[model samples]
Target: MVELKSPAEVEAMARAGAVVAEALTAVAGLAEPGRTTADLDRVAADVLAAHGATSPFLNYHPRWASSPFPAVLCVSVNDAVVHGIPTDEVLADGDLVSVDFGAVLDGWCGDAARSFIVGTPRPADADLIAATDRALFAGITAVKPGNTLGDIGFAIAASVRRDGYGLLADHGGHGIGRTMHEAPHVPNEGRRGKGMKLRPGLVIAIEPMLIGDGTEDYVHDPDGWTLRTASGARAAHSEHTVAVTDDGARLLTL
Candidate 1:
């Protein structure tokens, strides 16, 4: 069943969202060329600690995974899409890095992701990132009372398709609250005016994963987590946790 959060619960989630935003901001600054992905993960852990928040991603074992997740951050570099485990691999000058993170505070959860260029950006990398960012906002704009979940997905997919980008169809957003994932899976593409109707107090994480070469096929890394483009094309991801309110969509992770 889809659970609706109370106003007080929403406030608690906002606090968690603030921690998520702060950690992402701090880690983004440290994503330099010579730093290992593990280094960025450490920064994320420290930021969460400073805010008295706990990482929701740490040691998280989903039904599809073989082992517990090892890091607080999903550092996907270049062609990787999402769930890229942090490792000792050093970042290069022109690599596109996508960082996905989540946090829990006062029993509520917040999740978000961002993609950025390390040093010198390669051709079309900035465009790819911008497209995903735009798609995320498009999804957010579609969240309102009486609007269906399909409306949110259609808006996101329309924005991505306009830029000629390919979305990771199998993976999409999800309802979030006390748990990291919940009911009412939010896909990135769907028919408008269909699916579950949006209502006040409903909260979800809307994320867009776009590929530069317009391909949806991806391969999982041997580590049983990381997902990379099957054609070796670069990808970008952007996400934000939002709440459907009486007025409109309130972005908790802003």
Candidate 2:
């Protein structure tokens, strides 16, 4: 069932979202050539600690996962689509890094992700990132009372496809609150006005993952977590936690 958060619960979630933003900011600041992905993970871990927040990602074992997740942050790079585990692999000057993290504060959960280049970015990579971010905004824009879930999906898919980018299928955002994942799974592409109607108190994560070469095909990394482009194309992802309110959409992770 889709569980809605009370106004006070939503406010508490914003506090968790703040911690998530801080961790993402610190991770972005520390991401550079010569630093390992693990290094960025440490910075995020520290940020969560400083805020007295816990990671919902740590030790999380989903039905599809081979084992419990061992890291607080998922740092995907270049062709990796999502859930890239942090390792000692050194980042290169032109690597496109995407970090996905979540924080739980006082039992509320906030999740977000962003893709960026380590140093100077290739024109194509920058475009991919921009398209992904724009798609995320489009998705967030659809989060309002009376809008359907399909509207959110259509908005995001249209935004990315207009820029000649493709998105991974089946992997999208979800309802979030006391738990990181909740009901009312939100897709990145859908027929407008075909799904659940958006209502006040509905809180969710809006994320868009765009494929650089304009194809939905992707290959799963043997790690059972990381997913990569099947055509060896690069990808970018962007996300934010948002709440559907009486007035409009309220971004908790801003």
Candidate 3:
């Protein structure tokens, strides 16, 4: 069933999103050379704890996973596109890190992700990150009542492909409100005018994962998580939870 949030519910979700934003900020600050992925997860955990928010990622037993997720945050590194489990692996200078997180506050949910370069700079990785973020916002710009899901997907895909980047064929966004994931999974690519019509009060996560060098091939790690690029290229991810409204998209996870 499609759950439409009233304006008041939307406001409440924004509160949850604010906590996510704070946690991401804290993670970014602590993500640097000599720090382990576990370090990043620890900071995010502290932020969620301080806010009295619960993590949707921690102990999450999605259908495809062999076991429950073990951490509060997903610390995907370099070629690993998404679902990279946080571990004791130390980060090095110029390594790309993507942190995906979700938080629930006051019975509402918010989810988001951000990719960044740690310590030293890598021009190509930075460019991919910028492009991935642009693709996410492009999808967000298309989130309005009367628009089709295909339109939003096309907007994101066009932006990514324009820069010679590709998206993960399987992973995409989803409806998010009282729960972290819900009906109507949104894709990164689709034909315009197809799919269900978007409506007001419908909130969804708009996330774009850019496969560097425009390849869709990825290797699934033995850990039953972590998707790495087959060619060993880097990847970038960006996301924001948004609410459809009479005006336009109201970003919850800003």
Which structure among the candidates has the greatest lDDT? 1
Per-residue lDDT tens digits for candidate 3, residues 1-254, read 87999999999999999999999999999988999999999999999999999999989998988999899999999999999999999999999999999999999999999999999878999899999999999999998889989999999999998888978767789999988999889999988988989999999998988988888888899999888988888998899999999999999988
Please, what is the TM-score per model? 0.99, 0.99, 0.98
Candidate 2: tens digits of C-alpha lDDT, residues 4-64: 8899999999999999998999999999899999999999999988988999999999998
TM-score, candidate 2, is: 0.99
C-alpha local distance difference test of each model: 0.94, 0.93, 0.92
Q: Could you tell me the TM-score of candidate 3?
A: 0.98
Judge candidate 3 against the unseen true structure and give its global Cα lDDT, from 0 to 1: 0.92
Q: After superposition, which runs of candidate 1 have C-alpha atoms over 4 Å from their true positions?
A: none
- For candidate 1, lDDT tens digit of each residue in 103-123? 999889999999999999877
For model 1, what is the error of residue 151's alpha carbon versus the real structure, in angstroms, after optimal superposition? 0.4
Model 3 poorest ten-residue lDDT run: 162-171
Q: Give the range where candidate 1 is weakest over 10 consecutive residues by summed lDDT.
A: 118-127
User: How many pairs in model 3 have backbone atoms within 3 A of each other, for residues 3 or more apart or on separate chains, i.e. clashes?
Assistant: 0
